[model samples]
Target: MSRLYGDPIEVWTREGRPVQFVWRDRLHAVRRVVDHWVVSREWWKTSDSDPGERRFWRVEADPGSRIGTYELRFDTAGEGWLLMRAWD
Candidate 1:
């Protein structure tokens, strides 16, 4: 089963890669990165200042009791991290 969320989260990164994250007051360690991608249009060419680029990481993680896959999103313009989705 899978779930979706847009909750803000705190992440710890190493060399621009998420190594750990805190979601709903629990820490989840990133075991492996399943996929990585960027979602954005040609915002840089437009007059709008914000690039509107977002980076996404699909990762396998362990929260001590169980292991699951999660989708994490990083908003470059706002400099925030979000727990986008989770799988069990």
Candidate 2:
């Protein structure tokens, strides 16, 4: 597995579930979501830190040629998306 830290991503969602995402200058279409969860924290440290709930999804995707399982997260405090890691 390869970890992609702080990788910005563009996600497409339907009914609050991620359907696709763009990462590493490539677009990956989600085939099936293996799991989904959430994590939340309070704002106490730095103002720059993203506070509130974050939604995460573990999905299998196809980047046209190869298939990969990826971990994606959405920051609720800022409504930003990130591609966390990819399973080899």
Per-model TM values vs. the true structure: 0.89, 0.85
lDDT of 2 by residue, 1-88 (tens): 5767768899999999988888878889999999999887666732565557888999999999899999999988778998888888
> Once model 2 is optimally superposed onto the true structure by TM-score, how far is the C-alpha of residue 56 displaced, in angstroms?
0.6
Leading candidate by TM-score: 1
Worst 10 residues of 2 by lDDT: 42-51
> Tens digits of per-residue lDDT for model 1 on 1-88?
8898999999999999999999989999999999999998575544477777889999999999888999999988788999999987
| Cα-based RMSD of candidate 1 | 2.2
lDDT of 1: 0.93
- Candidate 2 has an lDDT of 0.87
